[model samples]
Target: MTEVFDAIVMYQRDHKEKDLMVKMLTRQAGKRMFYVRYGKSKRYQFAAEMQPLSMSTFEGVINTTGLSFINDVKATRPTSFLMTDIVLNAYMTYIMGLIDAAFVDNQPITKWYDLVAEAVTKMEKGLDPQGIANYFEVQLLPVFGIQPTWGQCVICGRRDLPLDFSEKLNGTLCQQHWDTDPYRMHIDNRAVRILSKLAEIDLHLLGSLNLQDKTKQEMARLMDKLYDDQVGIHLRAKSFIQQLTGWQNRMINRQSSAKEDES
Candidate 1:
């Protein structure tokens, strides 16, 4: 029997037999892989619908082994820009890719799906991609049961001062426990306040914080470390983002040096 599901594409890849394996977070069925016939030749492939970050209705037949064969796809949202625009393309890649790395198959992903959908729409509305990515990381980490304890010390029941963030302990540490772990990431009050605000804010309304670059870097570093130490699913897109950031920094430095030489 064939079934239809409203879904958002999370990750996609080429199959060995000239087909496509599209991993989607669906409204009804959670995460699913839909294998499309003739997905490579473009004669039958719905490129827009098959692209990652697209919300589309997927009509497919599920096999006994839980795999699905996509019969058709109809785009439910305008997602062509996700492929065409370079910046949006990269943002969607990381956003949906993180979701892909976070959840298991066929689980109840309705909330996560809505979160991804909303994030995509927010990006389209001109939200800061880096901040949005950080927001997604902070939100998704909790879903995987690996969030950092923000307000108080993980030891001695102290809430007066949160001094350090320990990825190994998965929470904040006070001065007493600060040097206890050599691997603890230092957490000043400012960074703690920033992370606390990140943890508490509504994702939909989080685009205009005016955070400093250092704060943003700290948030991203802590989130990535938490995902690595606890969640254990390595996100592939994150590496690419880092590379892009490094390249941009090098270009900026080169331009700065040129200006200094001229002066």
Candidate 2:
């Protein structure tokens, strides 16, 4: 049967000469794949939206067994910020990869679809990329049956300000609990507060907040380990983003040094 759905392109891969398989997260349906008649080339009108984090409307046909083929697609939204800014692009990649890792094929995760669409839209509108990403990361937990308890220590139920996080406990610990394990991910009250705020803040208001670099760094470190240790799933997108950012930073540094020498 022919079907039309609102979807965001999450992943894409090229097959032989003129065929590309595209994966999408539909708003009302589960994850789905559709085949583009022509390869993802410059000539393809919908080529730009075939990349990760692009939102589009999909028109296709599904067979009896639920496999679908794409007839046509039109871009609904452009994640222009992600493509224009390297750091933002990396963040978008991480978001896409994280979702891909978290969900199973053909599983309806409309919540995630909405979450990504909103985040990317905000990012496109000049919202802080890291802030947008952190917000999504915290929200992603519950969809996968992993809601974090941040206000109190998950281990002993201590209500005092948390000092560190325990992967075993899947949350933070008080000072007393933290000191015993030297290898625990050390966290200050600020980090915890950031996490709390990130979890609760509305996407539309994300642009209003000014996040400190320290808090962003801390959250990045904490959440990376949390996802790996607690969820046992390491998102490759994080590493890719880090590498891209690192390389981009080095280029900027080198350019600055050359400019200084010229001066």
Using all chains and alpha carbons, the TM-scores for the candidates as numbered come to 0.82, 0.81
lDDT of 2 by residue, 138-192 (tens): 8778766788777677667786555576666667778777865667777657877
- Model 1: residues with Cα > 4 Å off, grouped in runs: 16-18, 62-64, 143-145, 153-163, 173-183, 187-189, 207-209
In candidate 2, list every pair of residues with a backbone clash: 30-108
Give the per-residue lDDT digits (tens) of candidate 1, residues 118-141: 877777777767777777777777
In angstroms, give how far residue 246 of model 1 lies from its true place. Answer: 0.7
**In model 1, what is the error at residue 239, expressed in angstroms?**
1.0
